[model samples]
Target: MSLRTLTLSLLLTLLAFGPLSAAIGVPVTPATTESATATEAAALEAAREYTASLKSMTAKERRTLKREQRRAVKDALENHQDASTNTILLVILAVLLPPVAVLVYEGELNNKFWIALLLTLLFYLPGLIYALLVIFGNM
Candidate 1:
């Protein structure tokens, strides 16, 4: 998944779990706003509780979770995969240097990346848009 997609999925997950609310910048549906706020508070409390319990975890479980997270992040950064994995940093990178992002996703400065780079060199807008598409697997 693209970083953009990953970030959005994470945001939605947080929203659904009540870990986010308008107070954080994104607005929730009016019908769910109250629920969201309540959920957010609960989520915070749960997180705090988990933090307190962290030391109680078996070392293997913690290592497994860490490994999984690392693998997911690595896959997201290197592959223009699915399941919506957009991250803020990836979005910023895409915006600031689209060609480089394309190269990273493509794993080389290959044809697609070159095209993106050329477009970027020729015109910023086309380059940026093309890079976004490429990184998101549209290309």
Candidate 2:
């Protein structure tokens, strides 16, 4: 097989296998998951601190605080949520061209893009729904 075909096949195979492997109870140790849980706890603590700090600001301070919060939220969503696409720009693109939204959200021309594009061509609603789901981590 050609390289592209082989790679695509492998990707699809792994995609198909992942949920089944999880359902079948693949063996895994707890050490790696423990570190991940620790990081989540730290992040949760930071969020709590942020919310508490917001409660004591003056009106002008609250306006500045909101702008800062917006910047931080946008940065976090861009880097982690939507694969580094500029948040406002990505939302506009998502509204105008849904498949392109999927491409940007994934940061690659991957399976999700192809699937969204195909669905879009076949029917706009399904494509839009799938793109939204993927973008929002619902699917």
Candidate 3:
């Protein structure tokens, strides 16, 4: 494989598994070792296939591919950021107004919002708990 492919493969491998592996302090076993090897092999193979396809494409096609990839990555990042902000806002709203939080999280005045409103009206704690569960459950 070319240098670009190799670099991309290594970056992907790290991005895919590095954080989880570092965060989890589980001891390595035969099963874990086998799975790790399989994952690495799959990543390498995917990178090779991607690079091979790129090699066969014309310069214009490559430029278009790169542009599309960049746009996709940017959109994904923006979506993630929006989700984080929404979650934070929802958490605050859940504490202050459980029904409103549910409505915002659900993006509509539906059954969930009605349930939350009822719960909040009947008892504050239950409403808060339900709102938190609904917000965090989907995550």
Whose TM-score is higher: candidate 1's or candidate 2's?
1
Distance from true position, residue 11, model 2, in Å?
A: 34
Tell me the TM-score of each prediction against the true structure.
0.40, 0.37, 0.51
**What lDDT would candidate 3 get against the real structure?**
0.82
For each candidate, the alpha-carbon lDDT, in order, equals: 0.74, 0.75, 0.82
For candidate 3, write residues 15-69 as lDDT tens digits.
4564575758776656678899999999999999999999999999999999999
Ranking by TM-score: 3, 1, 2
**Candidate 2: deviation at residue 124, Å?**
0.9
Candidate 1 residues 1-139, lDDT tens each? 9765665576446545653454477855465788889999999999999877777889998888789989999998998645334444454576778888877777776899889989989977788788878766653
The RMSD of every model to the true structure, in order and in angstroms, is 13.0, 12.3, 16.4
Cα deviation at 130, candidate 2, in Å, is 0.9
Best by lDDT: 3
The number of the candidate with the highest TM-score is 3
Q: Which stretches of candidate 1 lie over 4 Å from their true place?
A: 1-86
Q: 127, model 3: CA deviation in Å?
A: 0.7
Model 2 stretches astray by more than 4 angstroms: 1-85
Residue 3 displacement in candidate 3 (angstroms): 63
Error of 1 at 17 (Å): 19
Clash counts for all predictions: 13, 0, 0
